[model samples]
Target: MAKADNIFNIRGRLGDFIFCQRNGKTYVKRYSGGFTKAATQNHPNIKVGQERFAQVSRYVKSLKQQLQPYLWRQKDGTFHNQLMATFLQIAKNETEKTFNELIHELDSYSSLSNKSLNKNSKIDPSTLLYDAKTNKLNLGIIPYELAVKYKGLFLEVATGWYGVNDGEIFLTESNRQYVKLDGQTKNEDQLVDFAPADDLDGQLPFVGLAVVYTDDATSESPHPVHTVMACFVETRNG
Candidate 1:
């Protein structure tokens, strides 16, 4: 590095040299172009960092895509970065835990619990129950207040499953079920069901919920959509 005596007083990168002012005096130095892929891949420390980053990115991308339908309107921009950092920490430090374990623990360890489709809505969201024996996920009843609030409109409830072993999502048309929300009823007792294929056996299951009002609803209000992460189940084998 050397003092910059040029009249231009350049304060940015110019070719291989970088000019900047420090302590009211301009200085110039050779710009570091950063490490090459070969250099980073060969370096022991950098290589480990690279591997961890790749693993984290792969898992994060898959999960975000699976949850995008429900989280499209979320305003928090840093959630993804926060989740990535969390996963990266696990990837680097928790060598014994499998990738599926990370997915299973997402609701507790990551920012998933904070995400909601309709934050200001008055209606309460339904809960979920998973059955390991039947490979089915059950959606609990939606309160009658939801029906009265929505003017007797049906609730469109959908379930999604994420298989960490294959990095695939198993949400299909057959997985969607509608629950009638008649204002007269005390509660909607019909249990919504989602069944995953047998091929998903022995894979980690991460389930989520997406609920919205039908288009024909006569309610004049905010029409809340409830999207939630139900549970992450252990890898089960038949």
Candidate 2:
């Protein structure tokens, strides 16, 4: 026996019904045979008008209760159920919105309520990084943007997984890769013949713009921390 989701019981009968507005009058009728016809005239039900929606308040209250425990894992990130976490957060955070409106933005599920569905349901937005008009990354234009944005900042133009020569001002292709030994690929920035100044941090300009994507652990740091990513590779072009 499957559960009846939206069915209503009227006059001791297990059937389906809907409330509708006709002209200026509101009435209730069976899901079928009640659209243009009335319960007394069309589907021959025992009741008519407004009473069809009597159970609606109870159903709405039940739905509210069912959603109470939604995404308990979201506020506490100890658990890893992605679906429940996302839906619960979305439902709770968007106070001005309703679940019905919020659900349209979600991918649908069946047989299981999404409230308890535990699956890897995440979307990465990397594709959205492209230029909307050209549908490409305009890498050529980024150099100027970098110079402007990082004009006053002290930046390590070169980053290394193995090691970096402290206070170096040059770079080379071999600098892109890393090695376990010190001074092997560690001295990448020495390849440049940068003009020396009294103060390298203030007088020297940054080599170019880059989009370094370090892990969030470094977010509190004034600059990026360990395990820097591929954006440094493009900085060489600047």
Q: What TM-score against the true fold does each predicted structure earn?
A: 0.49, 0.18
Among all windows of ten consecutive residues in candidate 1, which has the lowest summed lDDT?
216-225
Tens-digit lDDT track of model 1 for 148-225:
555545555445454434544333322445665564455434444555655454433444332355533222223223
The segments of candidate 2 whose C-alpha lies over 4 angstroms from its true place after superposition are 1-80, 105-128, 137-238
- Candidate 1's C-alpha lDDT? 0.52
Residue-level lDDT tens digits of model 2 in 1-238:
1233344332322356455444444455555543544434554243322222223233334433332222111222322233334445544565465454433332221122112222321211111122223212222322233334433332222222111133222222211111121222222322222222233222211121122332221222133212111221111212
Task: List all candidate RMSDs to the true structure.
Answer: 7.6, 21.9
Task: Score candidate 2 by TM-score against the native.
Answer: 0.18
Number of backbone clashes in candidate 2: 2
The alpha-carbon deviation from the true structure for residue 11 of candidate 2, after best TM-score superposition, in angstroms, is 43
Candidate 1 C-alpha RMSD relative to the actual structure: 7.6
